[model samples]
Target: MVTAAIGGERPVRDIVPGDHLCLTFADDAEQRPVVTEYLSAGLSRGERVLCFVDRTTPGIVLDWLASTGVDTGAALLGGRLRLVPAADSYLASGRFDAAAMVGTVRREVDASLAEGFSGLRICGEMSWAVRESVGTAELARYEREVDAVFAGRPVSAVCQYDARLFGPDQLEVLDGCHRGSVEPPPLRGHDSLRLVPAGRAGRRRLRVIGTVDDRTHDHFVAALDAVLHRPGDVVLDLSALDFIDVAGLRALANAAARLGGHRRMRLAHPAPVLCEVVRLLGWDRTPGLVLLPEGDVA
Candidate 1:
């Protein structure tokens, strides 16, 4: 984003790298421009960027990047970003091999370093769950690893932790490394069902929006059965869903089928991952899904 204020042409994607990261934003928005610019600049320096985002709405950060037309793949090492799924998903990890969320990011960092990605970016998005997980030891270790990664190569780790979620010390670490802060607009998610519609339309609109691990897949399946039982009119509002495991998705599919004769149930709010999963499993015909604004998909 170019600004007359900065008097410079800058890509929001490449603004900061090495301890002296500088992201220039308008006099209006507080710290966001600085934060994203730092991420871009850090990536330009060949340092993989790690963003600690609010897990609840982590997609917002990425969505913002897309809006800014930033090459996030270059900014992130995997060409795809990583996030710690919901806190509950992590809690369920013990029962599943590939399901358990990374308990401590330090271990994940160590493993990644050992694997030698040259440049790696890990973002623990801001969320209530992430804040609880960021204990003293975990926070300290994470910082140490960031320093270690930099020492090994010109690595620039950037995590956009929620100011509300983190304590002084945690913020200190991100800021200590000179990682700029980017605050998202207020979260846009329904906290709870204000009034679950029992009508046919309500039933069909409730989209299945979560992933399930092996152990929980059955549980998820069981719960979906109840939703399935709620008559054919219910809809699953999945628009905000981030991740739903294969088995989990399968369970939802089964739910849809079970209600096929009785009612027409469908999914809504499909993130990219959701679409991929739907296609991979050959369940692409959206039954009761809702489309984002027309211009969103392209």
Candidate 2:
């Protein structure tokens, strides 16, 4: 039940058991880096790593892992890592069956524990369902039912979706079915700060991770400015943000002022210090800024 919306390799490396994640990638360039980090982390932690592959063969996957510095050959030799074909699992019976897939996952979890591994980590490329014409209902059912297999258990799974292959409506449906998603790449990235687009079409959200201090304040302002131009209110998810200085706070205030009265910039789950600063400066009553407490939906 440890649900989270994560972005980048740093967060992917922190994924734990019982967390089911959805990863919708724009292309292989985005997908491969995250997958590589996931597999490497699981293997390093001594978990049984299972990857269901589509759009790439097992051999290519191994090669890619090796190139990315994963100890693929050793992990495979030790039987701690498995590269499964989508056909052999998701479409084994010539069509997708939600019950059958759930059962398969349950069995794998049991088998992994029996093998004395720390836990089971699984990731699957989900394009096969679309290719095979699996009904959306069936796909959603599989995602929901699979949760039972991981809930409170030593199992973590990530379901990968290709954004290019799935339509917006379909992607939104699939997104709602999972507890969390592996976010798309950052709008801006650096050692000090990473600003990622967490917003969907109608719901504009941005995640600010790491530190936003003097060094990164300009980048933050630039990124935030671009988001402010879009229609609708903006939500800044600061749950993962470690630090933000006065310069960063000024950028937020300026952005809110520019938005006027029509649009707002909502700060969701901001740090205590940030809240205090806003209150002390009377920015909390700023016309275009909204402060949301933790657990309050934007």
Candidate 3:
């Protein structure tokens, strides 16, 4: 059934140029320079610019923004260049935590908005971010809320997304958000899951080369279950996977547990993103863990 709106038209633009500029970048590297260019231009115009993103590649954003070009010197002059949580991140990441991540931005941006200005020019990935309550039901809730940001301001919004990841269901969910033709990002490393032969006989590995969400997790879990029965190791390669919320992370931990009891459970090449989440939640202290060079060892 049609539970949400499809990618029809974007009726609102909440970004304002005088004070703030917000953008949702595609999940890659090259598009980031574009984001920085916008920031530099906004800063040059004495506007406060805040870019929204998840925890996967914080360094990528910072590095690109600080590089020469786009005139960020003015932003530094005015102390306007900042990185704030994209909208609805309050719900995505706890308020306290999100606030911590962008505290500097909050103080400066809030000051700008408070001083004879309009509202906040917030932006973020709007595909599946909802006002949530609890449980996996939250997944559905998030997939539904999409009110335009900077509701009443003279702002420009640019959203970058992956066409390959966009199926009918995902596109339909966008409903009324105006977007451009799909183009590949500069650093296109959004990899997919592939089965690789493991060392030794009868051992194959499952490598998810991109973000693993709840839905993907379910399928992965089932696939792992099927593979566990074979008398060999099924390694999970997480070098490319970026975003995984609490539930998804727990599911992987659980799967590892199961495999350990039966035969062998192994994870390899976890990017800093996965390792940080696992460490933040104290998963490292758990027993039967092998620490990979990248992530937890278990």
Best by TM-score, which number?
Answer: 2
How many collisions per candidate?
Answer: 40, 0, 18
Of 2 and 3, which scores higher on lDDT?
2
By lDDT: ranked, best first = 2, 3, 1
**Per-residue accuracy of model 1 over 1-298 as CA lDDT, tens digit each:** 1211211223344432232222211111323554545545544545445555434354666665656677765445553344445443423453312212334444555555576644455444333434355454554444444444433333344444443345444455544433333322221123321112111101113333334465445555554554444322445556545456777666666666656544555454556776776787777664543234221321
The local lDDT score (0 to 100) that residue 155 gets in candidate 1 is: 38
Candidate 1 vs candidate 3: the TM-score winner is: 3
State TM-scores per candidate.
0.35, 0.64, 0.36
Residue-pair clash count for candidate 3? 18
Error of 3 at 251 (Å): 41
Candidate 1 regions off by >4 Å? 1-31, 41-52, 71-118, 121-123, 126-134, 167-298
Q: What is the C-alpha lDDT of each candidate?
A: 0.43, 0.79, 0.44
Return the top candidate by lDDT: 2
Candidate 1, residue 274: Cα displacement in angstroms equals 59
Tens digit of lDDT per residue, candidate 3, span 117-210?
Answer: 3323333443323222233233323323222222234344444333223333443333223322112122222234333322211122455555
Q: In model 2, which regions exceed 4 Å deviation?
A: 1-10, 187-195, 200-298
Where is the poorest 10-residue window by lDDT in model 2?
Answer: 1-10
